[model samples]
Target: MAETFERLPEAAETGGWLVRDEEAVAAQRGVVWELIKQVGQNLTQGVSLTSVTLPITISEPRSYLEMVADGWCYAPIYLKQAAVEADPVERMKNVITFAIAGLSNTCVVKKPFNPIVGETMEGLFADGTQIFCEQVSHHPPVTNWQVLGPGEMFHFYGSGELCASFRANSVKGHQEGIHCIDFALDGGTIIYGLPEVWVRGVMWGDRIIEYDGLMTFHDPKNKIIAEVKINPEVGGWFSWKKKLPTDYIGGDIFKYTSDPSKDRSSVSKISGSWMGCVLFDDKRYWSIKDDCPKFELIPADDPLPSDSRYREDVSYLKAGDMEPATEWKAKLEDLQRAEAKIRKNYCQEKGINYVPV
Candidate 1:
């Protein structure tokens, strides 16, 4: 069984408290809440910003001296500045209102354990215009200690009403393994407002991840545009490799060479691991040396092989001239039909719906 915790009021106005004698914890939560609110305020003004929330949950054994920090942190500005441009009244009302509601229940966990570290999972959903998000983190503690402070904040647009629910739970025992889940949802609509767009925000360490809603413009005079449904799932595993610095070389291939004016350079100087894959068009072309390979046309109506023969055929095609556009188009159609058939067969086999976009 999991131990349940009550949802704290918005930390922005009334300061929140969970564990007693933890003034620092409460202050941290309050600051985070205010930051979330600020982000919401900026969004309404057509500003796209990214933020991070760290260590949503924490637990551990008093003897181990092992600390586990698990929570949401992301590092990418999700929405474009152009997505929110509209009348100031409508934008402010919608953006600020949405941020307060959206940041309502984000979870942060920080605990100390041994040998095993903690993990987190996060996701977002959009029902046409409305957007929602959830984050979860868990840890096992050795000594009995009450959870002190945990807080979260979600942000969205103000054109819709804010009706979201938040929850968090924890448990411990001799058994091993930690589980956590978080969710957020926004619903309602505006009769005469700007077009709807779905937006989701996430935080992972110093990185911020966002799934900005898709837009389709329709009217030029009214500047009417509709945002499509967006479902984005963002999470990361705790690993030591993440701490290591990458050795990637910058700029195009020419920048690393001895001569800037030369069109052809020595290929051997390009020192990096090379992986090859086949490209599909009218015909198959296998990539070699990260450059365009030769092209050959395959019979469009023929069945694609299930064995290594597919790679062999691709290699053979790349040894020839580029396939004609007419042949390529026909082949593409055949490939699409084959894909549809495969999907249908798999859905029937698994007793699932065949929903394709």
Candidate 2:
């Protein structure tokens, strides 16, 4: 542990966050290689960056709570709508629109903080809504969350899986999950998931994240489906600085009467930006920007001993205390790594199988 922390000065020194072109590539790769050797054990396959090779300085230490919480920031937007508006069809439209508002946060490439397994987060809304999230697995990592709203509003339970790959210049992630939200009022639920994620131009300067792939939503009861696909525009050689269409996050959406495979009729086309407005049937539907709320950050003083939010290092990081943050972070990661080995052994001894689901 001491030896790994000793490399921090070098990692920070080699972290060329400001350089460009080959020079930047050289510096970024330099740090990456050192991290691979110093902090990473099995560079291939499942490994949690929260306690591994991720650089202390650049890594976003937000947590699974913050990442998934982005979707609920605008809770009232849909929750309020779901409360009233008795018409079943109208309610269904609002539900889909509500889900769309949640995904609106996915239009950009800010890396979320990784979560340690067993971490949990919960929040309450004035409207009597309760939101909770938990990091359930570390290998083939999975995060689960639920939202229960007031006055016969809705019940939502979702789980997300993050699978990633490495390349010379960047990292890519594929999000796989068929999470759903149930509104018994309409006897419907919307099931959906995200697309492939790319940390583009990682070797150029500060890494940029771009999400490209197909995002789909389906409602088994309502027999309706929605699709959102993000595709990158072409770029030429020496296009390091050239922006791609994916960067813009402009994509078309199609709402079908049912699953496209089974029923492709009654399709309504929507073309627009995921971060902004989209043209739908000659009208425009806007995306969420600041209309959401930040997750209630658990205060250090109020956290239970077991809460990840209260970990000394995380507290210091949030408070802008760099020295303690670094020290505690290193110790915490070390502790987690050791605990993982013990858990693995215990599982084997007890003949218990930890399932991803």
Best by TM-score: 2
Per-model RMSD to reference: 29.5, 10.0
Clashing pairs in 2: none
How close is every model to the real structure, measured as TM-score?
0.17, 0.71
Best by lDDT: 2
Candidate 2 off by > 4 Å: 1-30, 33-52, 82-96, 99-113, 125-128, 205-207, 232-244, 247-260, 287-305, 351-357
Backbone clashes, each candidate: 37, 0
lDDT of each: 0.23, 0.55
Model 1, span 99-211: residue lDDT tens: 21122122222222121111111122221221221111111122111111112222222111211111111111111122111112221122122112222111111211111
- lDDT comparing candidate 1 with the true structure: 0.23
